[model samples]
Target: MLSTLGLGLLLAGRVGAFGSPTADAGRRGADDLVPARSLQEEVQEVAALKPITLRGGVLNAPPFAIDNGDGTYSGFQGDLLRRLSQFALEDDYNLTFVLSPSPTQYNEALNLVASDCNTTANPNPREECDRFDLIVGDYYCNADRSLRVDFSPTWLRTTMSAIKLAEFEGKGITTLTELTFAGGTACVPEGAYLSEVVKAKFPGASYNDCPDPEACIERLKSGVCQLYADDELALKYRALNDRSLEVTREQFNTQYIVWPLSEKMNPQHSRLLKKWMYKSVANATLDELSYDYFEVKFCPLGLSGPNCDQDCDPIHGLSDRDGRCICSSTKWTGADCSVEVEEDLNTYPPWEIAMCYSFFGINTLAVLVCASWIYWQRNTQQVKVWQPFFLYLVLLGCLVSSSSIIPAVQQSSEGNGNVPACMVFPWLFSVGFSITFGSLFAKIRRVYILFKAAVTMNRVTVTVKETFLICGILHLQLLEGLDSNHCRLALGVDDFCISAMLQDSQHRYQVFRVQVCGGRDDPKTGLFLRAAVIWMNDLFVICIIFGSLMHSVHFGPKKDVNIGDAVSEYARLEKESTTALKERKEKFVSRFSSIDSSAEPDGASVKRHSSGGGPADETIDVGSTKTTDVGSTRRLSAQISLASHPEKDEEDHVVCETIDDLFVEDDQVLK
Candidate 1:
């Protein structure tokens, strides 16, 4: 931004050509943006003080600017000034051209324009820097100079090229290595940036020290230099006037050709210059000026960009060494130069392999501990009952974690490797989970079947034939192994074993969780078919572990004495007490019958049954005992002689007995 000081705007009055602006209307549109009254007055006041413009226009670079013997400038630069003179500065300030620049005088021109040339305390500023205004030239733009001077955005790109004698061939993207073994020397101008590239490529190669582009071309003509290298525009211009020279059809390095305005140039003036030239550059007004100066209808432009097509064209006598196309292209990268990349779906990437190691280690340790626990506690009744189910879990874990100790080198498709993980884990998982879920399910099933039997028919016990099915399945896996392509993940889409062999262990873990939790495949791959075979390996593990831990659903209660057994024992005790009482009564009655003379009274003939109960006979009462026999039932009664309720109603104190106590399920009374 330009400072708001009034004198700065006055110092910024120089008028110079930068680039062209797209006309909102035409060149006359400037009438709409009239300059400030103070600004216009300042431009006029400055112009009166400085008599000559002394514009920093390049003098020696031909076709750009030419110094005719007359006291006026002519060439491409003149035409640029002509276009810019009308609208670049305020209308009242007279714009003029002055001191011409050359390729060799870049530093001098910079110092002169910056007003640092006079180094004294009372330093007098130069006309180009302080008074007359701007300098124009094909200055190589760089950041170092941009700080001291203000250079415009590139008006045009100066493409560099190599020129050879007539009858030379080869047209393509510039090869950085082409001239390295060219078997001869490459001539370049002594002071240009190209000298650095040439020197670096061939440190000891012969160099034709031409002072300028013109000298470089002369050396090419006189056979003093075998190859002449310079900017493409300059070479093409030279080649146009001379018949012996030929410019390579390819373009290589390029530099910026920009208009350099003084740092002291006014911000408002710079903005106006930009507004005017932006359209001119875009619309190619300067290119048109080059065309007019060279008197050619068509001119060349910068060659193919980074995105040039890589289709080597044989008809144009051009070919691609790398993938770059020999002709024009629209897309970037010039991609179709090689066969498509194929990522190994059966192999793990570094990070994925690392994660697999972690999973395998942890799971393997857990499995080993479980197996050890099962082995150590095999005698325990709980362990004994669940031995088959726990065996399945151990085997599945072993398969899941085999890679922990299985070194990569030892792994093979037929043996212990990723192939086995895919091939065997599924079977192992199925077997393990079958026992796991089967046992759990069987418990609930046992309850149902037992209840069903108790109510209707007979008991149903779980058959041990499940082991045979697992054995059959194992034999089936062997059958698959016999086939040539059995366990292969996918012959074409992926190897047999698919992504289980490819994905990280964590991914596989998530996959199993997803399968169990939601019945969905891993969302990452969404490959359910393959994942099914993969997850079926651990399905039982997931079901058993997850159900037991999460839902509190486990196998049946451990076998121990229960309330039903206790009630049965109590029933046996009651029957034994009754037998003891009957024995005691028999002993007493046998003893008393031998020593007594008693009267016998009976309702009818007493039917002898048991000593505890018989017919209603013998009017004698033995300690409140009474008995009766009716049909097939014998009733023995002991009177409840409540001392407190001697006159209780008969209904309340008659008898206490239930049908369950009187008869059992077989319709037999308590023995």
Candidate 2:
């Protein structure tokens, strides 16, 4: 039985027609995005631009790109484009932000900006320098871009340094070579120039990027990218909130910024646009813009400008009101708003912390302990009828109690960060429930065999013959029961596909028919009538056979009498007292049989001594006897007359005496 159940579960679990409906059906389009390239590669490709219809995606310039409602562009890129639009159209040109439906579309827009199909910031000259001019957004000057376009002296100049993790301080990471070899890695924006420098200088070091400086630096707290490497100004904006990061390496190069114009660019109207773009790069022009966009600070005392304060806090250099930190309402202060106003732990909310702990810590073992207590209190010393079922239930409870085992083992063995859901539930249910059902069916077969033996001969061993016959019959019956429609949630039908059929009353009749006829169709009613007949027929046969065997063995004929002289003399007296004779007959047989003989005569006749006042009664049919009842006077005389009586009378008296003895023996034997 166990083997059969296990095989059934195995068959159900096989990669066959019974697989889950939702296994690999649906997927999202964004999941199909292509692999990302390095920042250097991205910049090189973006430098090569061409024309296209639409260009819109999220612009990631920290403090510059603002995500405004109604999907229209704003911020530094917005302001720069408006000024240049006067030169292109002689009026302000408004750039509109549009949502990219998917990652593929988003990347396509970025590619367009790179190719000059639409506007883009800081396209390199090596790829598409002649394709289009940079009208808006910051343009960086490189050795390659300088060959194709003109440059201003410089709009912004700051230190270019490597920001090592604070933990790695005092480790002598002065040179670019030492910074790369130092156990920590760095991060840079996807298309930024500094990302290129790190990749070139230290090919073995790990570097990552994000479009925005704040986002790129946030990875440090997440432990994604350990160090943020960018222009000093951008890193300073990030460090205002997270004061732990500090620049470890000295400035490698002073970066120059300029707007490039296409050689084939429309010189007729674009000349004025180029002049305005350069004019906009003036010191005061950028300083005000930078101050409005970001909370800037001068790092180190010597680099402080007139606006830069020498008394600025060392942690942030200087505080801008809108930076990440804020004063607590209760006088608490910290970088992440984690400081306490009072020293008491009770002042801190207790329930919330407890709830958080429970969410992560509570397990099935805790549930099992509670459940076991309840079971023990209820069951005590009582034996359960479904003993095997209860045993399997306990086994399942144990498995649940140790539920952490599989997950802990898997993680320790495979070194994976996550567990697969599909493998857990499917396999667990198959194993646990199979044991439960197998044990349950086994007990059922056992009880049935015991019953069959006791009813038949009163003595039958629990041999293989009885066990196999009983269990096999029940197992086949179980299979039949499983296939029945009502038990299958009453959903089976042959009209349409079975799975597609809904559970409605209309389908219920079909289910009923299938259950009754065992899937056989009847010609007259077009239903399965034979199923009910066969099922009931088997039950009826078992009932009749069992009942008959019990009856025959239990209430078979009784022949306990030994008819000697004693039995014969009782028979003579019994013949004389018919009332006693009738009562005794009824009393003896009433224990085993329900035959009605209670209406027999109450007295015997003296003439010819007939029982029941008639001819010899055959109520006791074990033997043939004719005894004449002699009256009381005659009874006394009969003893004297016995010697004088004729041979025929003596023969009759002998027969009666012998019959009486037999009745006495029979009665004693029966008792």
Candidate 3:
């Protein structure tokens, strides 16, 4: 009876009995006898059994796969898986994802999936036997990994690099070779492919393995490691957010990241994954997805070539957008910065040198001639009155100031080689200015004091010693200038000591027109110091001019008054007038007495009158006449008048004489 049923169904199928409604009634009756299942019913039964759910294992790597803490995931790999799942759904493939358990590092993520199949125990295990059908993250495609799992088409291409604290760059650890030679400890994720590269390339360096990238970074931050080796993309991402971290410019070991599939995964599913990945790559969707997460394109730093295999010098070469090398400084030139540029020595032009020497010579000659003349006229009143000591100082200052031109021109000729000249220029100029101005200020101050004393009738004397003391005080500015120069030399900007190179259109080197003392391109601090010195000198000049004006106005010819001599002569004249007046009074009284006695005739009565009041009256008249005739008193009055109003013609002579007397007195006191 079962054989009859199966044969009848087979016959019904052949006769198209169940396939079309247009079948004859006879065929339909036969199919009803067989009781056959329909195609829709079979599909429903298959669907009811279970869906082909693919378990995808993801590693926790930022910008690749990040767990949302709510059992969801996101990032480049996450978005890629989502899009691949959507594609698979259209083809009846159900895809699901699962993150690696806590503390599952990148190097161990693949092993978690690969270990599930136990292929050694069962060579041909069921497709569903693996813990994960595929693993995704920044899994590098390499021969060692390929033995355990198959890789999908390349998802991302990047190079391996090391990251360190930003300060390490300043320590000259900007390149891989530098880091290796420095013998610093490197933090590497346990079982990471980078460990192999680090070991092979950096034999000089020691390394410590952390459970994962985060632990490695922690180790780096905690000072356990000076460098952390990882993929350039991930390291760059990490460095972008952390200002203290920096990615090394020298990257190596180009790697391709891909989804790792379990060795026991169904071949059909593996084909589907490869097809999807290749399609995404061809359509630029993979790059678009990468941009959605990374938001930046990857390019090896300071590397240039058709395949980015050429390395440019990190110190002297720069890579352009097209990955071609360009020289960053004039010190080097060539495609890869392998050639050293020859620099032409530049010096001051003949005319400038000649001019500087001429000025210096002329100044020297003037100083010598002035000095000789002053020495020859040492005994002259003009020279003595002017103070030979101060005159010599003025000449010395001129000589020193003019000598600064020597160093200035010499420095120009020597470029940055003349450090001593650079320091000497300011010292010479400043000290010279201080001496010259200070000396003049002292002289003017002395004259001002003298005139002031005369005007106020005060006994104030400004001696040569006091003038020298004042000059010495003013010369302290020299020390200040010295300190400023010293500071500039000690803590000056790099450019101050470094000479700049310039090439003309004709490729001719030009002299570095830098003034060692006060260059125009000096740093703000240096410029401020120089400006302060100039302002101080200008202040001195203003003070000198003002003091000179005061001296000239107060001690003009009309107002010349020698208080020392005038006061003494006035006192003498007053005493002599008093003595002369007393003498005349005495003489008058004696003469009146004699005349009264000698009177006769009317004398008896008159004598009585004269002896009493007449004689006294006669004595008073005689005294008045004698007082009028006293020439000494008159001469005393004339002398007082002359002192009060000196003759203009003699004013100059008197001033010269007064100055001479002052010096002479000082000389006498010193002797």
Best by TM-score: 3
Once superposed on the true structure, which residue ranges of model 2 sit more than 4 Å away at CA?
1-59, 64-69, 80-135, 147-154, 164-177, 208-215, 241-249, 260-264, 281-283, 293-671
lDDT of each: 0.51, 0.44, 0.63
Predicted candidate 2 versus true structure: per-residue lDDT over 1-671, tens digit per residue: 43333233223332232234344233324576445457576334323422111122344444334556554446655555443332222222221212222112222223333434334444344433332333323456777555645443454556676565566566645445664677556677676566777678677767776765667667865777666677765555555545677665466667764444444444543555545456656525566666655454433432233444333333323334333333334445554344556533222134433432332234333334434543553332222322323443434433432342232223212334354642453344334334334444555566555454443324433343543354345445434423345532556567665444665655786675553545754222311222233223323432343344334334644433221333345545645666665765664455223213222222422222355765442221112223334222121111112323323445455445644654565466445
lDDT of 1 by residue, 1-671 (tens): 21232224234333223222334235546567543346677556655642213345463666666678564566676667656544434444344445544335446555555535456622545433454356666666776667666777666677767788774545421232455555456678766555665567566456777776777777776777667777677777777777677777657667787777776666766665666567668668877876755433321222222444333333232333222334333222233322333433443335544544555565555556556655665665545444445355444544542432223212343333344434554454444444444444554554455454543334456554644454445445544435485454644665555666757666776775453555653422332333333334343464455334323213545455243344455556756776876765564455345323322222222222334664322222223433534335455344433333322242232322322233332134323
| lDDT ranking of the models | 3, 1, 2
- In Å, residue 518's CA in model 3 sits off its true spot by 7.5
Q: Tens-digit lDDT track for model 3 on 263-364?
A: 777787678778867877887878787665543332366687666789888778867645678788888888888689876555555665676666667667
**Residue 394 error for model 1, in Å?**
99
Q: Which candidate, 2 or 3, has the higher lDDT? A: 3
Weakest lDDT window of 10 consecutive positions for candidate 3: 618-627
The TM-score ranking, best first, is 3, 1, 2
TM-scores of all predicted structures: 0.34, 0.29, 0.40
Model 2 clash tally, residue pairs: 25
